[model samples]
Structure formats: structure tokens, C-alpha cells
Target: MAAVKLSGKSILALLLMYVVLIFVLQMWVGPRDRWAGYSVLTPLVAAALLPFRRTLLVGAFTLLAITGSYGFGVTGLSVGARFVVIMATALSFGISLIVCRVRLEREERVKRLMVARDRLSLLSAASSRVGGTLDVTSTARELAEVAALRFADSVTVDLFEPVLRGEDPQDLPADGCVTLRRAAHVTAVAATGRETTALRANSAGAGQNREVHVPARWLDPGRPAATRVLEGGEIGASGLPMPLPSAGTGAEGWVTAIAVPLTAGKATLGLAVFARGPGRAPFDADDLMLAEEIAMRAGVCVDNARRYTRERETSLTLQQSLLPDRPPEQQAADVATRYIPAGSQAGVGGDWFDVIPLSGARVALVVGDVVGHGVQASATMGRLRSAVRTLADIDLPPDELLTHLDDIVVKLSAESLGDHGTTPRGDIGATCLYAVYDPVSRDCTLASAGHPVPALRTPDGVCEFVDLPPGPPLGLGGLPFESVTLSLPEDSLIALYSDGLVESRHRDIDAGFKELKQVLAQHAGALEATCDNTLKVLVDDPPQDDVAVLLACTRALDASQVAVWEFARDPAVVSQAREAVSRQLSRWGLEGAVLTTELVVSELVTNAIRYGSGPVQLRLIRQKTLICEVSDGCNTAPHLRRARTYDEGGRGLFIIANVTERWGTRQSRRGKTIWTEQALAP
Candidate 1:
């Protein structure tokens, strides 16, 4: 009966025609027969076809026909039989009305069951579709498609800006005005008298559903039901859906619309508005309920996506901050670097790099990677980076710096230990490569802690990894780090990178190394360009993990810019050292600096000679700044202290500190060297 369906008016028309046919039959048969009683069939037919109200109308017409049979002067029956027939006809009409009421009630139940089954199917579809992804815009598109397929003709999804950024949204404002971004606008296609879900951004074209960012505008709470729903946190529906400001293509000719707020807990995320077109029936209460459910389901998904995006952004920011802003200004190398985080969905990893200026015109290039993702890994990277810098400040070698860093990592893991201590705390482990490049000797000293070997591109455009003694990864205590020192020619490019650049799921580590070499082999002119092009070739749009690269072009000081002299352990060499320094300054055309250089040479040479050591040595280097260094075999290092006014001997070291821009002492295998740097005029 449901398959061959009819509206109330159609059923009423059929009943009315049945009544007319019964009247025709009464007229055709003579009054001699009780054929007028055949009109009773009309009421029975009406019971199956029409509602109680229209059934009563049909029965009334049948009653008129039965009684009007008397107009034909019925002499075929006596008055008692006529009255009995009239009574039976009246009784039959009353019974038909009761039957009509019961039948209508049962049909109403069946319709409600069908409606419930469809709603369940729709909600199930929504749960499987909209709830699968933790992406805000994708969820919005799925909701729009599911809602518009059968229940609505057009659907619009709008969300708060912060929620789109993956943060919890603020409560609706007191004035009910809130900023919203149009996340999706989907319209259904009506074809072949059937509706199915195919997402359409506009009737002009169709494409993948992406986040829609139009000019930012406030939703008007007083009108245009989208905002009204957000204000009241309820569904807004009317005979004709309100016109949306940004409604597109298939949204026209809509006769029905409903706006529902997407709310989770006490916070309202945004709004969803659904519409129906001219050909479709106007929305009923059941549709309004279903729209609410869809909006509610979408709210939960958007909230989840919002939280995820917020955490990822925070982690990336922290990770970048923990890393370098730009390589510091240093003369040891011309530096350029690049850092790219994993894609939006994949969490941020702990990949970091730093360039630290070491003593004696040297630069330490450090790159490291931790095992995990998120804030913890980034924080650990920061801690290790800071530890490396602190050790470098004390003039530790590359191997010793990594050695201390390993101890720090071990301590960190030990501190995070749980009651069952088999697993190190946070599952912390890291791989690091530390390299120190000296412009004076043109030698790059490198050490590794289970890290990938760095690549070196020669000035002649040859690329190869500078292999070293690969040590155990940090956190496995008691492993000694080994240092490798190799000669780097001038203008050679040294690349320090995290394992992310050379580790892929589709290929082995060797393949990634081959690609890295290929990229570095064909050099771009600028270090910045080379770094960028390297990433473009090796990195995905959103890389699977964090990638960090640090590149430096080597520079060597010319022999003409440096002077070294060795003298016996005698106070007489101090004056000779001052004369030699004056001549060297004159040769370098730095004649103006001769007097101050003489004073610095005299003070430092005198200290090295009288400090009770073996032979004394003096070395002067000219780069961005003029460096004066004096060394000896004395195990004792000098201290700059306040000398008494009457004391002349102790003032030698103090005067050197006052005359130079900066001064410090570093211990070498030969002894200790007290070095001073004075600024040279630009």
C-alpha cells in the first residue's frame, strides 16, 4: 500500500468518485429492488482510502443517495423495512468512521517508523563519514554532503576562526555578533527524480572540498537565520529559508530552510544552515530534529580537529623557537640554513640545529634529532642544544662537547624513570653530529653520536659524505665519542643535516644519501638558494618528519694576515716581540694599529715569559678583528685582577684587558694561550 502512495486530496477524490458511481447505480436500478443499499460499499471504500474527516464527507454523500432512493416513491418495500434499511445505513456509516480512524492511526505509526529508520541510517552515515577525520573543513564538507542528499537541498557550514585554528572557541557574545569563516558550502544535484550526495561548491564547477576563506564578515544575529541559531542555540526554520549572504549556484529556488547551531558542552562552535528547493516538499518537524543531530555530530568533530590543530601549531612554534632564528654573525664560515616541520596532521619532531662561534676564529655546527614528537621532544632538543653551547663556550673540543651532551641526555632519562625502570623515561634517545670549522687552519673537526655523516661539497663541485667514527646514540651511557679532523679547502661547502633528510619509508637510508649527494652535487650559486633547492627536491609538500639543514662555506685566513714567533724563556724577548709585531702590522698596511699592537704584544709576551714556563710563542692574526695571542708551557693561567697603585709587576695582565676590546684564555695541549682581540677600523 505504501509503494502505491497517495496524498489526502487524492484519496478524497477517489472516495468522492466512488460516491458518484454508487449514485449512478441507484438511478440505473428501479426502486422495486433494494439496490440503493449497494451504496454502502462507498463508505467501506472510503475507510481504506481517506481519513476520518473525508471519510465522513464520503459517507454523508452515500447517506444522501440511500435516503434519496425514497424520492423514487419506493413501493417495493413497507414502511418498517424502509425504516430498518435507513437505520442500517446510518449504523454502517458510523462503523466505517471508526474503521477509518483505526486504519489511519496504523498508517501514521508505519510512517513514523520509516522516518526513524531513515534518521538512523543518516546518523550512521554521518558517524562513519563526518567523524572519521580530525580535520575541521573535511568534517564540514561531509556533514554538508550527508545532510543535503536526502533531507536538504543546500547546506552551509560556518565556524569560529579560533576553532578552525584548533583551539576551543569562545562563548557566543552578549550582542550575539561573532566572526565566522565559511568552511564549506554544499548544494545537492537533483537528477532523474532522485537525490544522491555529490559535493558541489557551485553549479558552475565542482572540485575537492577545501577550506573556504572569503572576506571576513560578521553574522547578523537580528536576521539571516544563520546567526540567529548561534545566538539562541536552537534550530531556526521558516516557510522559505532566509537568504544567505554567500549562497551560491544551486541554492536558489529554496522554499524551506533551517539553521542550527553547532554546540558542544557549553560552547557554541558555529552554525549549519540547511535548505530545500521549490520542487521538494517543505521541511517537517522530523527534518528539523535530524538537522539538529547532524549539527551536533559536526560540532564534536570540529572541536576535535580544533584541539589537534592547536597542539600541532604550538609544538611547531616551540620547536622553531628552540632552534636558531638565523645563524649568528661569525667569520669562520658563511652560513645558511633551512628547517621544515612535518605535515599538518603528523606531529612535530625534535630536529634542531645551531651555529656557535667558538674561541680562536672557529664555528661549531651542531644538528640533532630526538626519537619522539610534540612539546617534550622539542624541549629536549632545546636542553641538548643549550648544553652544547655552554660546553662550547668553555672551549671544549667537538668530541668532548658531545661527550658532555651525552651525559646530560643520560641524566634526563634517569630523572624521568618510572617505578619499573627498564625503559628510560619518556623513551628518550637522540642522534647528534657536532662539527667545528676553523678558518685559521681550514680544518673541520667533526664528531658523531649515532648520527648521519655530513656531506662536503668541494669548491670544484664534488660532493661526498665526511664519514667519522660513528658512536652510540646518546642516552646509552659510558660510550666515548671520537672526533675526526679533516682538511677543508677554501670555499668548500659543508652540510650538517638531521636524519629526516636521508631516511624514507619507500627506500633505504643509502638511497636517501644518494639523493642528498645529487642535490648538493649540482650547486646553486648562493648558499641560501642551495639550501632551499635542496629542500624542494628532498622534502614532501608537508614532510613526514622535521627536517633541519645547516650549510657553511669554508674560509681560510691568508698567510700574509698571520705572524707567529717563538722566543726563549727570557724577559728580553718581550721588546723583540713588540718590534716584530710592529713590522708585521706595517707589512699588512695596518701601520696605524702598530702602537696598540706593540703594547698588546709587549704585555702578553712579558706574561708568557715571566709566568715560569718553557719557550714562549706569540701569534698575531688579522681577520674582522686583530687577534694577539701569546702561549707558553706554563700550566698556570693568568687572572686579571686589581693591582695596588704602588705595584708595577701585576699590572701587565690588567693593562692588556683594559687596552683590548675583549680578552680570554684557552688551554691548549702545549699549555695555555691568553688571547686578546682589538677592533680594526672598517
Candidate 2:
């Protein structure tokens, strides 16, 4: 309805009906009787209509009608009639004034409740939405979107890191519709506990920008506080100035802003702000309070998510670095090494095993487990492994090498023990095994320090753990370790494993070893396949701990299959070797490579007779690769160097080096073997 028309018509119509009603009432009912009832009814009706202007107007008209007709327009009236009319009008006006006051209070209360509900709802949503997220950037984006949807017309988030001083501000997203760098905004919010905003007019006109600063009235700058405040720690309040309808331009265009502090555990994490241009609806105290609640919950969720993300990233990187792109190729006796970290932690570990070539025709085999996992364990494993190689190069016996390692551990523990003062036992301790094997003699010597015994699986499918005296664990001294010697029969397979393979929580060490033996027995025959199958049995699915396994087999060529020809220091020796090669070549029915072998054999025998030792032995074997070995008591090893045009003596080694596809020298305590290999006939 038009305000002017409704007001004028309502007043005129009301006045006209007032006269008519009073006149009729006075004539029909005695004025003396009506005064008391009219007096009571007028003020009661006026008071009932304290909230609505329409109710007030209608009630006033009714009162005037009754009073005017009964007191003035009627044929006869008593003294009480005038008193009733005057008192009724006065009471109606007084009630109308009181109603106006009450209406204002009710409106304010409703606005406050709505604002409070909005703030509460926003906080509740933020808590539930971001609590478990593991990515910080994604969480920031989510918070920004939630803030925009809940509080203001638009929202943006920028992460400010003061420690990272070299960052570019332009790269950051705009925050809360304000044109401020993210780093700058973070500084501002942190310093003042306030949010900056650009005012928006309405939901449709929210695009307009009007820069404004909110006061940090809720925070005390001098008081020390944590980064977050716990829920219910602080009460929140908000206020927004109302604009007059008739006010124009600058004076009337006052913007409204609301703020809620995001707090957890007595500290504020951040702040959320809502704002709009002039002519927008004003915010109530409850809005700011509700915002604070939402902020508090959001703060906790963000912190958790960030921590989770950091740990996940670090673990992933460490795991990748620990794992090799591919395992080492098949070594002596067809060895394959497969390493898998515990899937749960995704961290690097110190579990390692290796098949290292020794000075003689032996392999120095080892498998060890460090006390822990992750970056520290990985680094320690690297150091220990290097030490093992160094000790091996020095020709230290297995037992002596282990003793040296124990000494190193003792020193390391003593030096670093003070760092771990909180723990009763400081620093990590390791378990290790060192073994040396000679394929020729089929002899294996092993030493252990608190490590599980290596198992031997014979060609006939018999499996048994090696029996050895237990020694003290590394880093702790109680008893000295002694080497154990075992005859590894030809075609026998030996397996070394870390305790993680068989040691389950429910079983003791002996039971674990028994389990390993049972697993080996189940998968016998194929050495490589059995090793893999045994590992699978011991590991099962979802292994609770880390596992490392190394397996090797001994193969000895029979005397009939391998022929050795010995010669003395004489020209006849070279002729003898040539005749022997020719006879073998003819017997084997070989022709093309046979001449090359004879020439190589004659030249090697000539050199051995001329410049070398007490005795020389030439052995030929029909194996996977053609094996031709020359052994001499001379400790001096022969080298094939780049021969000059005038060089004659080094030509023998040069020819041998060229003919051999694969060759190596092994120095033993007694003598050294210079073995050269030719590819087998198809």
C-alpha cells in the first residue's frame, strides 16, 4: 500500500466511524454504565497492540468512536462520560509509546539471534569439513571457499610465510575481497587480530569494492597468547552501524563489517571477516560470536591436516631414496636379491644383505638389521656396510671383523650415549652375520653376534640350521665370538636371513628358526625358486616387520671333469701345454676356438715357466662358462697392460686377455689363480 494514501484514508475513516459508534452506544446503553467498561477496554486494547502500528491505529479509532459518541454526540451524558473519554485517549497514547520502545528491543534481539546462528553454523561446518584433510594448500582453499559462502559476498585466502622472505606477493591469492598480498594480509591479521575487506552492497551487487579496516577490539596486543585458543575460552560480540534510508552518498554509504577470531587453546589462529557496502543489511553481535566459534574449530582441523601432510611427504621421500631401481643381477650360484620395506611406515630401513666377491675364489656373504627404521636407520646401515667392505678388503677374518665392528659400536655408543639422556639405554644396536665360502673346497666359515643362524639346504632336500655358540650382541660385551666351520657339500644351498623373516610376536627365537627350517624344507630342489618360496612362507602376507634374505649354493666340478696339467720352468713346458690343448681340442671335437685356446695356453705356460714361481697348474673345466685357470705359487699377479709397438713380454697376457670373454684372479694364502673364461659352444 502507498504510505501517503493509506495514512490519510485510514485517519479519515477512523474518525468518521468514531463519532457514529459513540452516538449509537450512548443512546442504546446508559452513559453512566458504559464509562467503566470503555475506560478499561481502551488502554487494554492499546497495550495489546504495542508491536503493530496497524493494531494501534485500529484500537485508537475504536476508543475515539466510543468516547466521542457517548460523551458529546449523544442526547444525554453523565459527568463520568467526559472523564472516561479523556482517560481512555490518554491511556491509549501512553500504551502506544511503550509499545514502540518494546518493538525496538524485540527487533534488535531477533537480529542478534540470526547473526549468532549464522556464525555458529559457519564454525560448525569448517570443523567438520577440514578436520582430517592432509594437504595444507587444499585446506586453505577449502577454508576460503567456506568463509565466502558463510560470511561475506566473496572470499579468498593467501598463505603468508615470513621465514620465506624471497617469495613474490603477486603470486598469492586475494584475501576476503581485499586487494592485499597474502603475506601482507597474514602479517596484518597476526599483528591486529583483524580482517581487511572490500564492502559489497547486496548479494547481487557484491562485486563492488570499498576498502575498510576492522578494529582489533577483541584482542589485546600486549598480552602474550598461544597460536590457538581452545573452544569456549573467549566470548564473542559483533556490531554493525545502520544506514538511514534518506541519507545520501558518502554519509549514507557506511559499510558493515563483522569479525570472528579463530581460536584454539587460549590462542587465536586467525580471523574471518564479513562486510558489505552501504545499504546492505547490518550485522548483529551474535554474527561475530558465531564466527569466532567456527574459527576455533577450523583452526584445530587445519593444524592436524598440516602435520599429517608433512609426515606423509617426508616418509614418501625417504622410502623412495631407500629402494633401488633394480636389484643386483644373478651372482655366483644364481643369486637374486629382492628388498621390500614394511608397507605400513613407508620409510627407509637399515635391513641389508650382500654377496661380495672375496680375494680368493670365495664370496663374503652378509645380512644385517639395524635397530630402527627411517632416515637414521638408513644412514647407519650405509656406514656399517661401508665398514664391512673396508674390513673385507683388509683380509680380516670373519670373527675378527665382527670383533672390530663390536669395538666400533662400543665407541660410537659411548660417544653418543649422552645425547639420549632420557632413555635408559642410549643409541641403537645392530645384529649381524659374516660368512666366507669357497665354492672349490665347499668350505664355509661363519661368525655371528646375536643374529639368527644361517640355514643349509642340501641337494637331497635336507634342511638344518647351522649350530654355533652364541656370542654377545654388538655394542654389548660379555663373551668373545669364535668362528664356526662347516662343510657345505657340493650343490648344497645356504640361506641367511634377518630376524624379521620368522620372528613373530607369538613365538620365541627358537620357534622362529624352526619355522624357517620348515619353510625351507617345503620348498626344496630349485635353489632360486626355493629361496623365493621360503621367503613367501616366512613372510606370509602383510609382514609386521622388515625381512632380508640371502641364499647361495655350492657346486664343485669332479676331478674327472676337471683336468689339471702341471709344468716346470723349461721351454718343454710350453710345448707340453700346446700338445695338451691340441689333444683336448681333438678329443672334444672342437676346431675354430680350439686354436685360439692352444695359443693362449702356450703363451701363459711360456710366461709362467719364464718369470713365475715354484709350480704352475693349468685346469680346464666344462662348466656353464668355459673355465681355464692357471695357478702358480708366485705371489705376483699378472696384469694385461697396453702394449707398446716394441713390447714383447706383455704380449702373452695381452693375447690371453683378448681371448677370454670373462676372467679374474684370486689370491689365496698359499697361491693365486689367474682364471680366464671362453664362451661355451652352442
Candidate maximizing lDDT: 1
lDDT of 2 by residue, 582-610 (tens): 77766766666677788778777776676
lDDT of 1 by residue, 281-326 (tens): 7677667778778877888887887777778888888988888788
What's model 1's TM-score? Answer: 0.77
- TM of each candidate vs. truth: 0.77, 0.51
Kindly give the stretch of ten consecutive residues in candidate 1 with the minimal lDDT sum: 231-240
For residue 388, give model 2's deviation from the true position in Å. Answer: 5.4
Poorest stretch of ten by lDDT in candidate 2: 183-192
Query: CA lDDT, every prediction?
Result: 0.77, 0.59
Number of clashes recorded per candidate: 1, 17
lDDT for model 1: 0.77
The regions of model 1 sitting more than 4 angstroms off are 1-114, 131-139, 165-168, 191-200, 203-252, 414-427, 505-508, 643-650
Runs off by more than 4 Å, candidate 2: 1-338, 343-347, 356-364, 382-430, 436-440, 459-461, 469-483, 526-544, 553-561, 569-571, 585-590, 638-655, 680-682
